[model samples]
Target: MEKTPLEDWIAYKIGIRPGSLSREAIEQYQLARIRQTVALAKEKSTFYREKLSGVNPIKIMDYVQFSKLPFTYPQDIKENPLRFVCVSPKDIDRIVTLQSSGTTGEPKRLFFTKEDQELTIDFFNHGMRNLVGPSDRVLILLPWQLPGSVGDLLRIGLKRLKACPLPYGIVQDPEAAIAAAVESGANAIVGIPTQVLGMARHRKGKELAGRIKSVLLSTDYVPQAICQVLKEQWGCKVFNHYGMTEMGLGGGVQCSDLLAYHLREADLYFEIVDPETGQLLPEGELGEIVFTTLTRQGMPLIRYRTGDVSRFIPENCPCGTILRSMEVVKQRISGKTILAETDFLITELDEVLFSINGILDYQSTLALTGGKDCLTIEVKTERKNKIDPVAMRQVLHTIPAIQQGLERGTLEVIVGESCEFMPISKGTAKRMILDTREQQQRPSGIQHS
Candidate 1:
């Protein structure tokens, strides 16, 4: 018999008692868990003991008091990883290493015990319940070559739920991934947004029409434009998953309501704070997202600051789940651009350019051309032989954002040959905004932004 979903188990353990929880009861449960986690961190972790010195977890009865705790920066993890490990070396089950975008400092190394890893698997099992059913096949586009990687963990959860998983790793070959999905009778796909977009674009005719029923877009933000294209082309529901390796590979996911993400509140505490000041913000206000692990036993992070920006939705979700939901995460603080005193986020550009048909990949850079600040967008098409530049330009002009910028002389468009440009993030990672105005001039026809 298929086991119960992790969400149901969590609800039972927390005494949520479906159809009976008041807002006050939920908040009380969260506060009690936070207090327990704080006590554990101070007792076991050397780094937290020093950082949280003279602090009494029992006295932290409210949000304001909890916010007073010292914040954990990424640099601390990078400089001294073992200092944060709560468990002995012998007890460690696995170590996950993530290299910072070379633009930042050194890579961060995170340690996890068997229990810590299982929490994430549990979260995946619960979150996927929103989209997949027993006997449904899920195509995993993350790496699973290693023993305890994200894909491998997800495979375990899918098997527990009685759903089949195709662990194809990342999209080294979009065509092959699509072929495998269709041949395997996959009804759901889990992957990064860009690769999934490529797969949807490359899918010819009705080959994938009835096969794919849903997609759990993970590892990066899913642009509205990309979601629009996938729904129109494939006729499938798209659910966005927000997570990072630091946050245990799974954080939150959107339900059928599709308004916001129902967070993993059972094992994690979420907070929003001012990016510059580090002061906590009220619900419904946008700020940097911070997280505290309530259940991770190996390397427990207290008040760990995540650079991504988002806010808590104050209203209840239409789906009727009692867990708190968060707004769709926006671009990082550093990715915002300024043009004619008008601010443009990288996601804005992604929505406009990616929605156009035939464009497979793209890069947006802000540059100074002829002493005028200009937004230059470069795109690569899947089929260069079949592309009509005139027709493509018309399609680009149809987007209100791009068309407005072009009409006002604030933006420029350049279509490049396929594979001409690569992202700076390294190895299949897609970074839309690259500011090149500060760099030395490039040779002719090579735009800098």
Candidate 2:
């Protein structure tokens, strides 16, 4: 099997031959870059200057010492994003403002220089080679209308790699999107997980499915069930990409091995830490993902907490690359919620619900009604009367937390189906378990208890 292209790219960026790329060489380079980043952040960024007031960059020699620095949170950026800017206003090329869920206050703003964005494009160029090559047409189902949007950057990167990028924004009409894909003879697709799954299961999906050779799912967690469906139906290679807007929109991607993500180690340093205690965890131990930007010039973040839950793979990849591999993130620390003396995650629902045939997508809402915690699931199906609520309830009962809540008599489960397909709008946020117990009105949906 071919190794990850990122190994060669990282070696080139670090001024070493690809054959000489070793873990030791990468760590040495990362140490130097970390020191440089700390010094620069202290000298240029107002937020880092105060945050690292007592620390001397020269004295920080190893990763252990660097881990002592205070972590930067999303709240810190939302409080005053301008303070994190390491470059002058004129030098900054793009400013991405993100409104986090349940936040009514100021949104987090991330500044990026042209150079910073170019690094992302370069990463995308190499990362995409794992799925596509020259002249391969890829349908981009991400926001591309904006200048610095991920789709736009991906289009530029594909151009650099001599691939054709079909810039179709997020899926608003699955049929139309599928038609476009077929008309353009798209060889591959890059899209949100659920949206792509919906399209593949759509009525007109089979027309394009047989033609699509590969797919790259990003922006949200890629459910294994979704990958299975895509692979089974389309007979295509399914790749999961791990990234966020804060990581300059390009972090890591899966290689041909399809086991885990090959990290963008050339520009960022990643660490897994215990979520509650904030202590570093050993390799292969699941923890919150924390990252520090080593090459970012506009906003050099130091050990920013990602709130994502994943672990670094301890063993070498079967693809023969030495680049660090992280397991595909399946949960977030913030996604866990407690109700009726039990806790559950949206991911748990994803695993069970998406596996059932005919189910395209679903929304899970937990609300308190009549002194009981109610979990309502509104499902979208391929056809009317295709889903059996009894079977659905049986499948849902497989979840230990749900079973615990139900056996305690403090919770109830309601399942309903809607054949109407709802194509996700452009820039739609990730789907989460909505807790609406405090609200007076329940969500408008077909509910059956």
Displacement of residue 79 (Cα, Å) in model 1 is 2.5
Candidate 1, after superposition: displacement of residue 15 in Å? 4.3
Worst 10-residue lDDT window, candidate 2:
440-449
Task: For candidate 2, list the clashing residue pairs, or say none.
Answer: none
Scored by lDDT, model 1 comes in at: 0.77
Off by over 4 Å in 2: 103-105, 419-428, 438-449
Best by TM-score: 2
Per-residue lDDT of 103-186 in model 1, one digit per residue for the tens?
446878999999888888888877788889889999998887788898899999888778998898888667888888888888
Model 2 per-residue lDDT tens digits across residues 191-279:
98888888888878888757999999986577899999999889999999888888887779999989989999999999999999999
TM-score of each: 0.88, 0.95
C-alpha positional error of residue 89 in candidate 1 after TM-score superposition, expressed in Å: 1.5
Question: How close to the true structure is residue 262 of candidate 2, measured as C-alpha lDDT?
Answer: 96
